[model samples]
Target: MQRDAARLLYGNAVAGIMISLLTSSFLVFAFSYPRVDPLKKMWWFGMFILLLFRFIDVIWWKIKLQNTEFDGKKSITHFVIGANITAIMWSIYLVYCTNQVNDVQLTTTIIAIAATAGGSATVLAAHKYTAMFYPCILLVPGSIGLLLSEEKSLHLLGILGLSFAFVMLLISRKSANFTVHTLFLKNENSVLIDSMEEKVKQRTQKIYELSNLDPLTRLYNRTAFLEQLKRVTTKSEKQFALLFIDLDGFKKINDSIGHKAGDDILRETANRLNQFTSNTQLVCRWGGDEFLVVFAETDEKRAVEKSNKLISLLSEPHTTENSILSVGATIGIALYPNHAKTEDRLIQLADMAMYYQKKQMRSAVCVFNEEMEELFAYDLHLKNGLTKAIENKELRLVFQPIISSQTLKVAAFEALLRWQLKGKDIPPDEFISIAEQYGLIHEIGAWVLNQACLEVKNWNTEQEVIVCVNVSVIQLQDDNFISIVESALSENLIPPELLHIEITESVFASDLVVITDQIKSLQAMGIQVSIDDFGTGYSSLSAMQDLAVNMVKIDRSFVNKIDSNGKAIISAVMHMSEALNFTVIAEGVETQEQSQALLNLGVHYFQGYHYSRPLEIKNIPAYLEENQNNT
Candidate 1:
């Protein structure tokens, strides 16, 4: 308030000086009407000197003090003193005119005093004391001088002058109150706007954190990593190496110990990476059990060295509350402007290299090469060809019979999808992974469901046999999967009890509550659910109990090694199946020895090439007839 008052006082100083000079000129001329007098001259000189000092003060304020942080109270005090003295000088001139000049001159002097006092009441209102006092000084003494004169007309004029001074004081008080109130409201509004801006900033920061950061590891997420990659590839002219790291056997450890211990391992991995990498290098938690690191300005040798160091760093045993867990990593390195120039291709090649290393040699580092590029291109070709596989009639279903171990009769058939493009066979793992990655699994899964239901309904077997179709995790999580099942069953007129939905045990790692609800809903609708590849995934026993699936198919990996302690693992699963009241089917029984061993261990069913390779729709009837004859 004081600053504003002082600024306003000086801001219009030139205008005020002009008005004062004009008023003083008029008074001097009026007082010196007949001849020049020393009194008028002295009054003119005093006014000129005061105006000169005020003009210089304003100039000095503009030059040195206008934008500074100097205290305004001192300036305000100086303004008040100068303003009051000027008013006093004008009052003395008014009194002199009243005593020495004629009635006309005195009236002119009174008019000038009234005008100046009224203008001051409004102009100086920023400071209440100055506004009220300056006008009073200009009006009070002149009015008293007129009232003390003997002239009757002068006495009436004096009374009116006093009344006008009182009115000006009231006007000054009201203007000053309004000015103070407006400034107070302005300050309050400023504070409110500032607070609102701060809150918006905080919320925006929170939103960024939620979107760009991984909540568990507090590392940059996939979205943030991709964004950074795009920026670096676009703006940077220098080369950088992109490292894709996958934690080897993390799922096995997670499943064996617990997810909590797995989470501790992941956090420790992230902490180690963050500590090991410098600011110039970027690190991110790309997804579950995988991380991405970018080394700025590097070559293949340096990248290999860094990759080895990272593998060693991550492979160290991590200590959780109840467990000391050890995990290893496989790193794939792809260089910018060396292998691929674009961000997508760079990340793709890097991931392919990492996958190659993981598949060939666990816990190692591999740099991308031309051979990997060719392999990636082949996969890409398969991915592109898969989109039209169904349209081209190149996609077909082959059913493998699940036989009863005791009766040696076909009990169920698992429908599997096959894609043959130009007579070149694409493995299920290759094409299925591509399908899931490119978001084409939903369409392909629905097609498989409908086709399997239609094909199984046409099977002319006397005994009713169930048809099991493998479902992807993506398909199960989809909101429309249940509806797809209903559509297939209703369209094909297949019995709901005869259709089995085979889900992998990895489903337990996902949204368990929702998946469990989905499983229960399927069971309620008379459709049985089976956990395919049972021992392969790290599904908890409690999750398995909660699912209460109808059947558990031992993964072929365990069956391939059935002679060497694989039976122990399968025996444990068999015991779990008996305790949980579910049946067990041993898959991939390519040898009679393995089959006999499994049957001796009390296995319920068998499905593998040892019985029959997956047969076509036309071949199924003959196989069943031949099997019935054998029975």
Candidate 2:
């Protein structure tokens, strides 16, 4: 502040000194030559020398201002004070010299000196005290000369001069105050604008960071990952490894413990990847339970090895407060030069490989191969044709009988979907997932419900047998799903008791309250609810209990090749069902021994290829009669 004040008032003081010097020299040269009193001439010469001294002082101060750095208030105050004192002394000397001259000489000297003070008032007005003091000091020399005046007229002139100096001082002080205030407001506005700009800069930076980074793991998000992939593929000649990593069985973790535990598992997975990965690899969260790792400098072999190491690292048990979580990564690797040339193709190939491992449902890394691409192309073709296939009535269903062990007779039939496109049967495993992925499951599910309810109602004269339609999780969540099911039953004139809505236990992970309400509403309408592939999910007993389910169908995995542990698990499940008052239906009973074993465990229902393969709707009546005849 002091330095700025000094700089501001500098021009005024410099102008004051220059005016004094110029005027004094002019007065001495103009009036001293013709007929001068020796004493008066000497005094005028002394005044000229004093003005010259004042000019030198002003020049020296300006040089110092350029040469030396003016710092804080104290040094600037001292410097300004010295300049102001010199100005006052010049005014005092001019008055003393004028008092010794004749009236004409005095009149001219006072006018020149008063003009110098007048200029100072306008120039130095921004400094209030300095402006006020300047005119007062100038009036001192004239006022003193008036006090010792020999003539009354001279005295009145001196008094008038004093009054004029006082008025100039008041004007200078008011102008200085106004100028100082205006400058202060401009300075404050400048500071405020700068502060607001800085805040905006910081906020924009933070928003950018959040958009790029994942909150939980601080890895790049899907958008950032894709951008990085595009940059790498487009700009670099180097071949990179794109690894798509999916955590196997993440749904069970979420179903068993909850989403918070699931988040912890994901975080642990990310931390393990970060620790095990090489520095060149950029790890990112592709989406839920999925991560993408890009290796910038590596070959097929090194990439495989790196991916395998990452899988091993993730397999290490992560001990959480709830339970020990051990998740495995199914890695899919596609090399930049070898497998794909574009970013989308690279991610697609890697994702196809990852999904291949996901089908196996364990820790396995697969490299993109020519065969995989061929298979992906076929799957893509099926996906493209599915909507058309649905419209053309190419979708159909066949029923597999569930036999009662106690009665050795058909109890209920499970409706299985089939897509026959141009005389070729697309496997349910392939088309079903594709339907779920493409959000066509709701329509497919409604079709299945309509067909099965109508067919079963035709055969159900005694109203004893039920038809079960397998539902996808997506179908269950569909907004009009309940209406679809209700319309199927009302149109077919079928009792709800003869229609079972079968869902995998994975549905337990959905909003439990909502599922419970939905299930209760269906049950209230006389519909039977069952858990299909029961043991395949986490089987949160609470969810199973809350579902108010009537039956629990054991997954094929438990019954296909039952070991002692599998048998024990099956037995425990059977006992649990009995305790819970649920009927047990065993699936995949391929051999007589498997059926007998389930019968031994008190499971009363059996369904597998051993009894009968899924038959066409037209063949069901003949097959039922043939089975009755055999029995």
Candidate 3:
């Protein structure tokens, strides 16, 4: 505020000088009397010198002192002092003129002094002290000179002069107050605008960071990676390798442990990748458990070596506070200019190779090849066609019977899904994995459940029989999975007990508590829940006991070697089942020898090609009748 006042005072100094010169000239012209001539000359000299000094002060301040370093206090002091001196000079002239001149001349002098004093009120308003005193000094002496005269008219003019001075004083005070208030408000508004601008800049930077960075891992997101890749491709002369790394069985681990642990694992994965790679190389979380890396100026050998190292580093057990979790990585490498020219093509080829490696040879790395292109195309075709499979009636269910060891009679039919496309059979292993990867498992699984329920409901067997429908861990994890099951049962008019849900042991690798609750919910609906391929999964007999499952099917892998070293595992499973009060069914029972061995070991149920290959629903009646005759 002081700085502003000082600036205003100096800025209007020229105008004050001009007005003073004009007023002084008029006074000199009017008061050309012989006795006062010398006094007039003296006043003119004083006014000339004062005007020159004020002019010099304005030039000096404008050229040398008007800056950030300008001293507002010192500047204001000089202005106030100079202005008061000017006002005093005018007052002395007014007094001398009032005494020496006639009444008419005296009145003219009073009018000139009063006008100058009133004008100075606005000019000196920048400073309170200057505004109040400059006008008073100019007017008081002139009014006193008139009142001290012997004439009555001069005395009345003196009273009017004092009244004018008082009015000028009030105007100057008000002007000064208004100026200060306006300057204060201007300063405050300036500060607020500056503050708002700074905040907006910071917020914009933060938003940019968020848009480019992954929130969980603090790594560059997919959009940032693509932009960087495009820059590298356009600018760099050297070849770089893009590695697409996908964590294997991550979904299972994520499901088995809680998502919190899953998030921890992902963070740790990112940290490890960042530590392993140099600053020249870019590492980013591509999405989910997948991460991408750009190895600058790298070749096949180096890419393989680095990828294997990354795999080893990541495969180390991730020991959390509650559980020790481990996941593997399948990496695929595509070299710029070597594999493809465009950025999108490079990324797509890299992703395709990664999926090929993950699907073909897990925990290994593969480079882009022509074969992968064909396979990728085939996968694309399958992905597009799988949804339409049901509508076209290309998908069918074949049942493999689970036989009772005691009566050698059919116990249950494990419904197996088959996709026959264009007269060629696409294996369940291939199409099923494709469906799960493409997020079509939920739809397909629901259809299979409904179909299985309908099939079992149409059966006219004398012996109590049920149909087992295999469900994926992904499907089971769905919140709507239980409702889907209920709808299937209700729509088909099949009792829940006749439609057993056969979940793979891999389901245990997910949120067990939640899966357990879901299983209990199924059992509450009077539906039996069984663990399919039991020993092959990351679960034990103790887990089964806690699960309270109705049945446990020995995995085909264990049952395949039943006549050999597999007996001890089966015997242990049998003993555990007896103690835990759950039925054990040995799968992949190929020959009579395997069935007899399983029977001797107290296995009560069997399912495999040795009894009957999985048959279409039309062949099921004949097979059951043949099995009944044999029994």
Highest-TM-score candidate = 2
Residue pairs of candidate 3 with colliding backbone atoms: 255-510, 255-511, 256-509, 256-510
lDDT of 3: 0.87
What's the ranking of the predictions by TM-score, best on top? 2, 3, 1
lDDT of 1 by residue, 1-631 (tens): 5676678878877788889988888778655565436878888899989988988888888789989876789987877777888998998888887778888778888898899999987778778888998888888888988899988779888888899989999999999888777767876787789899999999999899999989889889989988999999999979889999999879767755678988889888989998889545788998899899999999999999988998999989888967777889999999998998888889888999997787679999999998987887887898899899989998999999999999999998999998898998888988998898788999999999999999988989898989999999889888898999999999999989999999987887676766888889899999999998887757879989988989998999999998897989999988898899999999999999999999999999999999999988889999999999999
- TM per candidate: 0.63, 0.73, 0.72
Give one digit per residue, the lDDT tens place, for model 3 in 1-631.
Answer: 7788889999989888888888888878766789888879888998899889888988898899988678888988888888889989988988887778876777777777788888877888889878988888888888888899887778888898888889888999999898888889987998899899999999997898899989999888999988988898888878889999999878777765668988999999998888888555787898999899999889889989988998999999998857888899999999988998777888889998998987778999999999999988888888888989989999999999999999888989999999988888998887888899989999999999999998887877887688999999889888999999999999999888888888888876677787888899999999988888888758865577678999999998888877677889999998888888889998998998898889899998988889889999999888888888888
lDDT of 2 by residue, 1-631 (tens): 4455555666455566566657756666666534545644565566656556656655765777644765536544654575576567657655765556567767777787677677767777656787777777877667767856777778777877788788878887888788778768876887899899999999997887789888888788888878888888889989889999888768666765788888888887888778777444678998898899988788999989888888888888877765887777799999997888888889899999987766665698898898887877887888888888768989888999999998778888899989898899889988988888777777778888998888887783332778898988778766687899899999999889888889888887666665777788789999888888888756877777778788899988989757667898898898888778888999988999998888888997999988989988888888777777777
Off by over 4 Å in 1: 1-64, 69-74, 86-236, 240-335, 339-372
Model 1 scores worst on lDDT over the 10 consecutive residues at 29-38
State, as a TM-score between 0 and 1, how close model 3 is to the true structure.
Answer: 0.72
lDDT of each: 0.88, 0.79, 0.87
The global Cα lDDT (0 to 1) of model 1 is 0.88
Specify the highest-lDDT model's number: 1
What is the Cα-based lDDT of residue 240 in candidate 2? Answer: 85
